[model samples]
Target chain A: MSGKVTNGAGGSGDGGDGSEGTPELDAAFFARWMTAAADAVAREADRLTELDSAIGDSDHGGNMRRGFEAVREELGEEVPATPGAVLMTAGRKLVSTVGGASGPLYGTLLRRAGKALGSAERVSREELAGALRTGIDAVAQLGGAVAGDKTMLDALFPAVEALADSGGKDFEAARTAAEQGAEETVPLQARKGRASYLGERSIGHQDPGATSAALLVAALAEADTAVEPEGDADGTGSAQGGSGGSE
Target chain B: MVEAHGGKRVGIVLVSHSKEVADSTARLAAGLAGVPDALVAGAGGLPDGSLGTSEELIVEAARRMDEGAGVALLADLGSAVLTVKTLLAEGDELPEPARLVDAPLIEGAVAAVVTAAGGGDLDTVAAAAEEAYTYRKL
Candidate 1:
């Protein structure tokens, strides 16, 4: 509650900004997030590999699958109540269970985001942004990559900056910025880590991490729509929200 | 005298070098772990005129894990690792959290199977495989 921005116990909706958001992200949302993450990776596993093969060892997709499956399995065991803890747990598990650079990087995103949420049952757009900021920092720490590196950070940093500049009141705007940032990674020259080794070769091809980063942003934006009063406003109920808690 | 323990709740999987051995081994292991909810999958093994690929067996085992310790994948060598890698490749996205434990073929399988059935973690199954590493005089 302290870390996440929320609407309190009242039934106030956060709109799309995630500020004025739910005081508590439900379990259903957590499940949806996991499914979204898995689906995102599954949809682009081959594409991810194609991107990685050009500069790295060419096993990004395989590596992602191992982590995602583990996350899905872990979720079945226990779903953390808060949005942040989920990401933290998922991130840690991926780091410990999966091998290679991507594991630590992706794991950081979830872990830092979870930490930002603290123990709050709900999170505000600001809180989510803060958590992601922490996550982006962790990735920088773990991978030591900066902006325009043709790595995940290239996309992640811009997204974070955009989110922060918006003051956490506009999830849609934040989402759009993240998407655009991810796309911009394609033209940049890799400056660090494995991708940098390829030098000019890394150009043109989209960074797999960046693509996945965009998917995560898109998933968050989608979560808001699914939970909003108009979208699935009916009583049938559905698994809505981000996997931030289950990570 | 193989035994499968606590496997009933988690639903474990069995992978042998041969179908007959796989079935027979399941029977022996069942006694060791008591009656388990473990799932047995061995469609004939390499060098045994069996019908399935070791990769398929591992994939089956992984699927079983997803169905519920996650999964403990035990194989009778030959193409076990290769198949395991192959299955892992197939899971280029959404891979299950199963471990490929190298269990001894003849005598060791019984112990591995029993331990795996006991709701053992991938680590436990792997340890069992290592413990069951003794070569029989046969």
Candidate 2:
């Protein structure tokens, strides 16, 4: 196993069960497969927060590192019984463990997504899309923020839109748009969070939340193809929702 | 200052969002410390570990320091401090000898580190960390 080989464009997709017998996207499989997503997050934790330091807050990587670490710990010794359970518990951990506005917003996204996932092991892209839509709405409700607010929601909204627009057919295409949407937040003034307090000062710097959002999309894309690294940091770095890695 | 870097070892643990970010910070921090300073080790988040939490990162940073006077953990927020504490308690053994300092991350990490490099104890090092939020106070 390559302990530390940096893949700039994301993914070495040979992960998750790509077998024919296990060719099912069932809960057990999804639970098993998401490890790739987990690894991607863990490996990139610090970089994510560093990007945040440039713009909004400098805690994105730190926050996600905490949340995902919890996920890995919870999944320890025993896998989550169902996809929904996995997400719900993860979301709850974020809400309880993480601090800041991101805690609730991201926790809501996961919990909402998990609730929609229910006990089923495997969910099609369509199923996941519905759940993500639920998550997006949940975030909006929880954070009282919307697109163009220069937050993770800005990146998240566009990705979901792209997903729905494509009828949930193209994960890569959707990821690209999500990434683009996240990057678009750079020029936006902060309408929320401490960065919002900074007003015009928040401009020019990349939105940390949006940057993380793009990482999520990149992880999702990695899940689908496990393709070789693309160009240097091709991601838009938006869609950057996080749980603040709080305790 | 105990004046130890020339005679002792130091460890570093930083919490960032990505591996690139972590490495970048580690590289810079390592450079800032100088070769004669202390031994610095780091880890990043990429969803590729036994656990993927920020607290885990802090612990991982702590663990990397095998023979240092103690560790100087730099955090991004108030709660990041809490997570690091939780991680340390779960059998991670952080006595007074082994310290965890939560400083103001972006600029504060460097300042606290610079103070630590001068050979301060955990309390003094941590106090330096507070400077991240109040550099102007100096």
The best candidate in terms of TM-score: 1
lDDT of 1 by residue, A61-87 (tens): 876776787887888788877676678
- List DockQ, one per candidate, in order: 0.02, 0.04
Model 2: lDDT equals: 0.60
lDDT of each prediction vs. the true structure? 0.61, 0.60
Worst 10 residues of 2 chain A by lDDT: A15-24
Write out fnat for all predictions, comma-separated: 0.00, 0.03
Per-residue CA lDDT of candidate 2, range B71-122, in tens? 6666543234434443443233442355556455546556656666666655
Residue B9 in candidate 1 has what lDDT?
A: 25
DockQ value for model 2: 0.04
Name the lDDT value of residue A120 in candidate 1: 66
* TM (B chain), model 1: 0.63
- What would the per-residue lDDT of candidate 2 be over residues A27-122, giving only the tens digit for each residue? 544444345556766787787777677664666677676666766677665677666777777766665445444555666677788888776654
- If chain B of candidate 2 is superposed on the true chain B, what is its TM-score? 0.68
